[model samples]
Target: DTAVSQTPKYLVTQMGNDKSIKCEQNLGHDTMYWYKQDSKKFLKIMFSYNNKELIINETVPNRFSPKSPDKAHLNLHINSLELGDSAVYFCASSLFGENYGYTFGSGTRLTVV
Candidate 1:
């Protein structure tokens, strides 16, 4: 029943470990986004890719990368995890234009120990 589904809802790892979060949208939206919410509860847009093309690349660390194999999928890969990397990572999808509306996933909680 999840329009947008992401794997590993909870992730606990040590510093320097690498991890990946997979997101898939069944709504057939043209654009997909990755957002990160820190412990302070501040949401930051990490990346936005439309139709498998890199569109919005925000100011994020090099350890983070977004990959879209097709329009329905967008995955986030994080390398060299750190304690500061602990956050809730959200995946969203939306269509562009006047009817634009975002459909977000439940989010993946990452705890870096």
Candidate 2:
């Protein structure tokens, strides 16, 4: 089984549409994160959740939200998608306190046209 998995790996939608991407990890990690990669391939962390609590939210736009219903799942939601929102979104998980390295899910490509 995949250690990490994300649903709807590819999404193409019009501007102003609202969408959500789901991510789940099977590795018993205590921390999970959502990252965004722009066209320039610049990877920036959007949010991090540890043990189902929000933490490490980098100055991400208010339109973006990270929801963690549980420790193993962290989902991302974007409202009023803009053309700039088009990018690859990655979900990753890591074991707290050990720096074991994060296991990343295959990224979801979002294109807003």
Candidate 3:
């Protein structure tokens, strides 16, 4: 079974369209996060939520929004998709108050065509 899951592994769309990517973790962890990995393979943390509360928000565009319905789920929604937004979106989870490594989901590749 997968520790984390995200939909639309490959997304192809025209610029200016809105798209969303959903994520879920089954590792019984309290902290969940979203990350974006650019073409250069630099992964940056976008948002993180613990117990349904946002804890980290990095320098991301306003067009990117993160939603957490519960402790085990966090989703990312993007508006007015742009070519620069094309990247691999990864969902991850880690245990709070513990030095545990993050478990990453098979990323979603977004392409602005």
Measured over all alpha carbons after superposition, the RMSD of each candidate to the real structure, in angstroms, is 1.0, 0.9, 0.8
Q: What is the lDDT of candidate 1?
A: 0.95
Candidate 3 lDDT over residue span 1-113, tens digit each: 98899997999999999999999999999999999999999999999999999999999999999999999899999999999999999999999866789999999999999
Q: Which of candidates 1 and 3 reaches a greater lDDT?
A: 1
Cα error of candidate 3 at position 94, Å = 0.7
Decoy 2 TM-score against native: 0.97
Each prediction's TM-score against the native? 0.96, 0.97, 0.97
Instruction: Provide the lowest-lDDT 10-residue window in model 3.
Output: 94-103
Question: Number of clashing residue pairs in every model?
Answer: 0, 0, 0
lDDT, candidates in the order shown? 0.95, 0.95, 0.94
Task: Residues 38-89, candidate 1: write the lDDT tens digits.
Answer: 8888999999999999899999999999999998999999999999999999
Off by over 4 Å in 3: none
Model 1 clash pairs are none
Question: CA shift at 88, candidate 2, in angstroms?
Answer: 0.2
